[model samples]
Target: MEHFSQTLARAAERKGGEQNLFNLVSAPLPEQQLLAQTDDRCLAIMTKVVFQSGFSWRVIEQKWQGFEDAFWQFDPHKLVLLDDSHIERLMNDTRIVRNGQKIKTVPLNAQFVLDTANDHGSFARFIAQWPVDDITGLWLHLKQHGARLGGNSASFVLRRMGKDTFVLSRDVTAHLIAQGVIDKPVTSKTALKQVQHAFNTWQQQVALPMTQLSQIIGLSVGSNERQV
Candidate 1:
């Protein structure tokens, strides 16, 4: 595998300079800041990402207030108590998207948030305590427990929530393959572990957050229009 320094240099060279490249990278929030998030907000983030999946994000963003109102601002306590009648009503509600399957994930994922918060004091606490080096494990936990959080959905949610994680976007995956981290897209647990190990190795070399490292690798190769 190529050294991370080489990758960083290549990325800097491609993106003007180190200053410009670093400007595009976002750091994860501190543990205290992450722990400060409420369960309702966490559930809200999950619901937004779940709804955005396979759909236009702009449409979701435009209709987000409707979603907030329809789902009671994504209060897990209330959502978990929603009966089938309420779900049926939401399916016909003009406020949010009418997709029955996606609409149903709100209550299901709400239960997931409530359950996790019940055990960990708060859902954010659970996320804050998870080891960044084993981020794939956290992804697995979300995929196994939360609704519609499979694939990169969990990663996107975590990143958006200011957690330290590497998203396996198309460019990131392509860079990983070029670096011999994995031969194809990460699907199985084994492949994910391999990807984690590669990131961990690169992290050891540079001491940068996995998010920035992943972005650097992505910027090293791919379309210039790609954002970090």
Candidate 2:
């Protein structure tokens, strides 16, 4: 298992392409990265993004201080203490989204976080149950629980706190295709299966072509480790 983990880490050092460092989809603005975060700071990030999603990130970025002040830094225990009077005050605060429902959802979501922490003792203990640790899973979970998504125009936010590295965007996949690292474009839901097959083929075919590929060559890309 250590070998497997080491091999996967080494294979991941190769970036998608030279231009990918600036690619829009893979390299998003602050909101996505901050919200997708999974550390102890995550509760505050998730709280801010829930309302921040209603407006463009540009707007949120400009007024984030107002939000910080408004929410008292998103302390879970303090937020749960908010009563009807607090809601009235928040509804008029221009610093936040000022939408009643989204405002209400904040304290409730914080309370949910508190409840989960109470039951599980910590957030890390909570996420360990599921095996699918993809970036999409994180963002989708947030969206399902009442956090907002930026409309189709601004940006596509996936969970990318960068703790894991396999959440390659559409552009990243295209670059891999150009490099022959992956097979042809897969536009359908079955794309994942095709990738799996192509990768297996890569593993079987790599060693026959060169002696240097025999568990050798520094940070090698066209080797068995690149297969999957």
| Whole-model Cα lDDT of every candidate shown, in order | 0.91, 0.47
Off by over 4 Å in 2: 1-40, 128-228
Error of 1 at 82 (Å): 1.2
Instruction: Estimate candidate 1's alpha-carbon lDDT, on a 0 to 1 scale.
Output: 0.91
Candidate achieving the largest lDDT: 1
Clashing pairs in 2: none
Each model's TM-score?
0.97, 0.50
lDDT tens per residue, model 1, 26-47? 8999888999999999999998
Backbone collisions counted per model? 0, 0
Instruction: List model 2 lDDT by residue over 1-228, tens digit each.
Output: 122233333444443432331221232223344334443344555555565654676777787788778988777778878899999999888887677877777676676667666776654344433232233343344445533432211113223222221323354355347545557554443554444343334334542111111122222234323322
